[model samples]
Target chain A: MARVVVDVMPKPEILDPQGKAVLGALPRLGFSGVTDVRQGKRFELEIEGELTDDVVEQVRQMAETLLSNPVIEDFEVHVEEHSVAEVAASEGR
Target chain B: MARVVVDVMPKPEILDPQGKAVLGALPRLGFSGVTDVRQGKRFELEIEGELTDDVVEQVRQMAETLLSNPVIEDFEVHVEEHSVAEVAASEGR
Candidate 1:
């Protein structure tokens, strides 16, 4: 199976209140030197086939259509061919 | 600068309606082997100065407070150095 990871983020110019709130909270959490924080979204998909150009395209389209907000957000899609368990196992080694 | 990446995911027991919707739409987008899609969130922060344990802990707390829904989500945090521009340039090579 192919695994796909999608990351979506607000445009840099846009104000991200959530991110700002996190930034504001960092000092109280015991982090003194922290200056900024930005928040975004991630999606992981397991597809039942080999990783191919067509599959990548479809995944990208999927991100554009339903995974991201075109107005204020930007997105990126990454595809790989391994299950999460397999990935964890390989990393454990 | 230290770069912090936070990935937040729904607890396996929680229902991800948006993720389900994305999974349902994948087939129409032309990905055939796609079986499941789990959507989550990613937060990238550019912190000023060196990366230290305290900084990492602070970033994690920030994630918990503002970036994720505590009841339904689980999270992981990663810290690195280098600006986004530098990271992009290194990847371009």
Candidate 2:
């Protein structure tokens, strides 16, 4: 199956409390140099066939209508050659 | 400031109810061809300087220790040349 990725991130003006919490917690955990943080969502979709343009368009529409909130967020979509597990394994994790 | 991206995904064996909910909701929204769906997280970190190896290493460590639950999730890190807003603008959105 082909894998498609959709990333939904809050608008630049939107406040991300989750990311803020991480930013605050990081310095306490001995990590530094991170000036800001924004948390978002990622979706991986497994499809039955090749990544045809028609299929990609369908996914994009899905992302626009259901996967993201246009008023407060934006999303990007692309196809991946491997699944998340495959990528992790290839890195020798 | 340079940006770093961390993508944290649940282990393949773990049950992802969020993704399952999306999968069920898709067909109802008139989108199809998706056989499966997995939901994950994306974090964007804005740093003060260039993306040096030392800084990248720090972000990776942060991902491991705080951004994700190691027992249930796996994360990948990389440097992004632009923030999500820039990318969207370039796409003429």
Candidate 3:
């Protein structure tokens, strides 16, 4: 099965409290040098077939309509035939 | 500032309703070829200095303690000196 990955992030203009909270908590936890943080979402779709344009377009529509809020977020889609686990294993080689 | 990216995903054994909802909605929206979906989170940290090992380790700790739940999710950290926008622009070249 092909793996299609969708990455969604709040628009740069939007305030991200979760990210700010993490950033604020970092120094308190003894981790320093972090100046900013932005939180986002990622979706992994396992498809039964090839990584075709039709499939990619379909996934894009999904992102626009359901996976993300277009007014406040922007997203990107990545298509791969290998699962992320397999990709990580190969990278370890 | 350097950009640190943390990618967090649900354990393979866990259920992902958001992803399932999207997967289910695809065919209803006239999009096909998708079989499954898994959703996750991504964090982008802007650091004030270099992408050193110390910073990477701190970010990893943050991921373990705050960005994700170790019980149900796994996370990966990526350190880049260039911001994502810069990287995307360069890739557009």
Candidate 4:
């Protein structure tokens, strides 16, 4: 199996209240050196077979269509090759 | 400058209400092939210097200390080497 990773984030021009909340909480949480924080979303998927470019494109379409708000958010997809042994080792019972 | 990416997610055993909420919203948003969706947080840092192993470790500690709830969330940090040309090309006006 292959590992597919998706990262979704609000467009730079958009106001991300969730990120703002996290940024506001950082200093109180004891992070001093941090001057700014922008929050986004991540998704990891274990596809059932080898990762091909076509599959990656399909997932990207899915992300654009339903996983993210294209009007305010953008996303990136990363596909990594994983051997069956690695997949089995990573799997949880 | 180097780009430091941090991904934070709730521990497998912890309840992630936000992820659940997003998963619930997917179907309504027209994502049919998706059977499951897990949501996490991402942070992109544009550090002011070359990314050394020491800086990566320091950022990891910061994530553990203030960016994530150690009791419930786990995080991964990825530091990519970015050349000045690539960095300049990627910069937005």
Candidate 5:
């Protein structure tokens, strides 16, 4: 099966209270130096077969139509690794 | 200045109703071939200085204590490119 990851975030002009909340809480928690924060959404989609450009385009359409709100957000599709387990085990990112 | 990205996702064993809702709606929209879906959080952190290992560690702590709920989620620290503007411009992911 193929796995595609979609990352969605607010547009540059939008205000993200959730992110702001986190930013405000950072210094209080003893974590400083973070100047700003923008919170977003991550979607991991599992496909039944090989990943192709067609699948990417279809997923892009999904992002445009549903995964993100075009009026305020932006999204990007990434061919994710096998799973988060593997990602945590390797790359460590 | 530096930018770091923190991605938080529900644990594999956890129930993701939001993801399920999206999955259920996918086929109705005629976008098939997607077998499963998992929704997560992505945080873009803009820092005030150069990217150092210590900075990465600090952000990891932020992900643990603020950006994510460690009990039910897993988070990763990634050195993000300058900005989402750049991601949207190049790589396209």
Candidate 6:
């Protein structure tokens, strides 16, 4: 199986109450120093077989048409061998 | 400012209708080959200053306490200098 991850975020112009709530709760929980927080959506799709360019395109279409609200949100389609943390660690990002 | 991303996914046993809906809509939209879809949450936090290990720890705590529902979800905290798509592309993931 192939794993393709899609990350979706609200448009910058949009207001996100859920993010705001998290930001507000930080100090109360004794975790400070955060200036802002924006919440989004993540989708993991397990394709039945090998991941080809055509399948990637189809997944992108799926993200744009059904997974995210184009008017107020944006999304990214990622195909990786591992999870996000490992990627970050590998690149030291 | 430091930009860190947090990715949270529902536990495997959890039912995700939103994801299922996306899967169901794919073929109707003429985009097939997807076997399963799982949805989660992504958070982008803009810290006020540098991203130190301590700051990372605080952010992790924030994620664990407020950003994600631990009982039914799992999360990854990534300290990065760019967006998720850029990261994925940089690593060719």
lDDT per model, in order? 0.71, 0.89, 0.77, 0.64, 0.86, 0.80
lDDT of 2 by residue, A1-93 (tens): 789999999999999999899999988999878899999999999999888999999998998899999889988888778766677788887
State the lDDT of candidate 4 residue by residue for A1-93, as single tens digits: 566767777777778677677667765765444444567778765555656777777678767776677777767776646422233236431
Q: Which lDDT tens digits does candidate 5 get at residues A4-56?
A: 99899998889999999988988889988999999999999999988889999
DockQ of each: 0.43, 0.80, 0.51, 0.27, 0.62, 0.45
Clashing pairs for predicted structure model 4, backbone only: none
How much of the real interface does each model capture, measured as fnat?
A: 0.63, 0.76, 0.67, 0.26, 0.69, 0.72
What shift in Å separates residue A78 of candidate 3 from its native position after superposition? 1.5
Query: Highest lDDT: which candidate?
Result: 2
Q: Point to the candidate with the largest TM-score.
A: 2
- Residue pair clashes in candidate 5: none
Residue A45 accuracy (lDDT) in model 3: 86
Please state the error at residue A55 of candidate 5 in Å: 0.7
Residue A23, candidate 3: Cα error in Å is 1.0
| Colliding residue pairs in candidate 1 | A48-B33
> Which of candidates 1 and 5 reaches a greater lDDT?
5
Candidate 6, residue A74: lDDT: 70
TM-score of each: 0.76, 0.95, 0.85, 0.69, 0.92, 0.86
DockQ-sorted candidate list, best first: 2, 5, 3, 6, 1, 4
Docking class for candidate 2: high
Sliding window of 10 residues with minimal summed lDDT for model 1 chain B: B80-89
A45 Cα displacement, candidate 5 (Å): 0.6
TM-score of chain A of 3: 0.85
- Residue-by-residue lDDT tens digits, candidate 6, A1-93: 989998888777789899998889888888878888889899898888888888888888887788888778777887867654344346453
**What i-RMS does each candidate reach, in Å?**
4.4, 1.0, 3.5, 6.3, 2.4, 4.9
